[model samples]
Target: MTANAADKSLQAEVNALPWFHQIDFGNGVLSPGWIKKSKVERVSRTLFDPLNVTGKTVLDIGCWDGAYSVEATRRGARRVLATDHFAWSEQCWGDRRSFELTRQHLAPSIEVMDIDVPNLSTTTVGTHDIVLFLGVFYHLRHPFETLERVAAMATECLVLETHLMRLPFTTEPHMRFYPNDELHNDHTNWWSPNRACVEAMLRDVGFKRITMKHPDYRRRRGIFHAWR
Candidate 1:
């Protein structure tokens, strides 16, 4: 088939949708996503090394626009499952159109689901060699329960990224709760835990090995690698 009117129509459809991740859709076209920072820039290269997952099953929780999902496939993961609920719900500025379109263009074999974190289990989503739980932890109302649930499905490793709080004088397990839209003017932003607290939670949930990948004190963000 030749590139014609149908192709242009499809490209137009993709451009019209609201995107969160900067997804490139070939032929010099790019989805003008809202997020300023690139996923690769935030996650970084060294972080991707320990979570190599070559020929291993990979799961990307809260996979908005399937950026990491496509990255996992690029790393030669045997199977990549991208799961999302909030962003894909088609409300607010989020919709599954970007993810669906991105997957169609890149990493066509990637599987996607609209499952929440609490419902994740061996029976529901099966087990994965590696799970990417990036930028979703603080949003959970039941942090412990959700972390435990995610831990159960990971056979090898879980790479996590979330907001952190630095007390400056104390190294205690503390988490600031936002009952309203106090955090970044968004109501979905619920909890912000300190670095020690995050590590403790991972240990409590049955991770044998825990490593802090990136701890940005200036930005107040943390990246942790937990091994099952």
Candidate 2:
């Protein structure tokens, strides 16, 4: 096949599925994803720039389209596992095709699991040196409990990226509950916790050192690194 024909075929396959993360598949073809490329690149830098995943094991929870998982492998992680359930099931509008295609064209060596947040544990998933919990905390109904589970599987560091709420006027940790599609008109969103709340929760979960930084896109959305 000619190069142009290969590019067209790749583009057609990518267009067949819905995507959440914009992934560049080389050959001048990029997936038509809802998340912008700039935003994803910015977030990726924030998530991956500071840390060295060389020869490390990584677990990316809620890896909707295998964006971070593939990147982790590219960044030198020896073993990277991309796991999700809702995103790959009929429970929601999305399925695993986009991720499957992306991983097929990008990094096939990376591992995958059809696991959900509640099922994640040290026993079920085993301990990884780095665990990525990006854009998933707020969507979960049980943030604290889920964090505990994620912490258990993260033997060295856990990088969490989530929607944040600013609860002004008090130093005490607080979280804003969204009973419905109150945030961004997405019903899947459940809670947005403040920075203080997140830090406190990390401490409670056994992280010794914690640091939080705001991303460039949103006003309060933060990416936190908790070290065990």
Candidate with best lDDT: 2
State the number of backbone clashes in model 1: 0
How much lDDT does candidate 2 score?
A: 0.90
lDDT of each: 0.83, 0.90
Model 1: colliding residue pairs: none
How many clashes does each candidate structure show, in the order listed? 0, 0
In candidate 2, how many Å is residue 191 off?
0.7
Residue lDDT tens for model 2, 68-159: 88889889999998999998898887779889898898999888899888888888889999999998999999999999889999999999
- TM-score for all models, in order of appearance: 0.90, 0.97
